[model samples]
Target chain A: MGDQLIFTYIVDGDDFTRAGEASSSVKNKLKMLGVDSDVIRKVAIAMYEGEINMVIHADGGTITVSVSDDDITMVLSDSGPGIPDIEKAMQEGYSTAKEEVRSLGFGAGMGLPNMKRFTDEMNIDTVIGQGTTITMKVYL
Target chain B: MTIGEIQRVLDAQFLYGEELSDLDADFVFSADMMSDVLAYGEKCSILMTGLCNSQVVRTAEMLDIVCIIFVRGKMPDANMLSLAMSKGIAILATKHFMFTACGILYEHGLRGGA
Candidate 1:
């Protein structure tokens, strides 16, 4: 992975309006790198969902994306209250996001599921009070 | 249908990307929830939603949705318009409710994406 391109961004939780900037940036970079349109789309959607989740629930986070010849890896780490039950959270309609978040057109409980759906591999690591980190890889 | 045709059918107003009016959409997906859009939106699709936020534009950008129809007379704010402009995503605001807008498009033969 010596030639891998790693891009990291600090998601600002204070501005819900700016949540997707990082994901958008990555999509542009992938496009410039001549990644396949379909693969670029999957990475964009997955990372966008993760970015939104961090803004809504985690009050902010760090997203690190690395692009290599074979795949693109995204690590979303947040300091928000960790998910209580991974199984429950994985359910399609289960969400802890506030009503305010729902009013913003999200919190449909599909974030995690959609992320998992778009990526080739996904793993969630969390502790009740500590934080959560979701690592997802999309094969090119 | 082209974004121009859809706009004409719905009598919608263009908030951005008017230059892309001639662009054709392969299909349409209507939903207010960004999650559903992310999960199911397809390429070259037009999104119809009552949600008016930057996220709507962001979601459409992620899914490669070519146009966004803000149904129910919902108008996007400056933040959303700026984002859409940057992404080159067309924005149409229709006074028609979501159901009616979708109905009109479906009746006119704009099926959902494959």
Candidate 2:
């Protein structure tokens, strides 16, 4: 809580190529702050996947990362169409990304699975018509 | 194997990070999909792909991948190269196909991610 760094980002939906900028920025800041390399990597990978999901699926979102002594906590909230089936989406090699997204070297059906792989904990909150929120944490 | 050796085996052009050509790497994974790379690649490795974009470089940065070799003679745009320089990740280019590039590196002792 006290003296912990709380970084927030608003991911822009329009620019597909710019999707990972926020995650990259956070990675650099964490490096400067001297977080452990392994912890930094896990956090970066999870954040990157979530950011890409925001761009490709959510149409945009806000991510808040709170860095403290014990763990790195991330909360990602998006306003796009919510996932109809969380279980299906959680399956590896399952994706709904369009062909164009696949052409861009993504939409590989690996995003959610990879996020789950890197984080110590994950939670999904969604509404059919509204949006979804994902909370993840990686213990440092 | 050093990145320079991987470049030589693939007949690659060191588009950036010539200073790091001597940096060592032990393996590679060829995929345009950053997700796959993130899920598969390991430390002291290189990523070979035809995808030309800033995210590729950013992904390499996040993974701490020492080198990225763009195959099929593709060149990343200015933004990507700039980001690569900022991140200190080596960038290379070659006319070899992804399969061929991975093979060459494997021929030179670099294997796929375990």
Tell me how far the alpha carbon of residue A101 in candidate 1 is from the true structure, in angstroms, after superposition.
0.6
Query: Which digits, one per residue and each the tens of the lDDT, describe model 2 over residues B21-54?
Result: 7887777878888888888885636888899888
Models 1 onward score TM values of 0.97, 0.96
Q: What is the C-alpha RMSD of each candidate to the true structure, in Å?
A: 1.3, 1.3
User: Interface Cα RMSD for all candidates?
Assistant: 0.5, 0.9
Candidate 1 lDDT tens digits, A13-123 = 999989999999999999999899999999999999999999999999999999988999999999999999999999998999999999998999999999999999999
Clashing pairs in 1: none
Best by DockQ: 1
- Report residue A49 deviation for candidate 2 (angstroms): 0.6
Q: Candidate 2's error at B20, in angstroms?
A: 0.7
Per-residue lDDT tens digits for candidate 2, residues A45-119, read 999999999999988999999998888999999998998999999998999999999888888998989899999
Docking class of 1: high
TM-score of 2: 0.96
For every model in order, the TM-score on chain A comes to 0.97, 0.97
What DockQ does candidate 2 score?
0.82
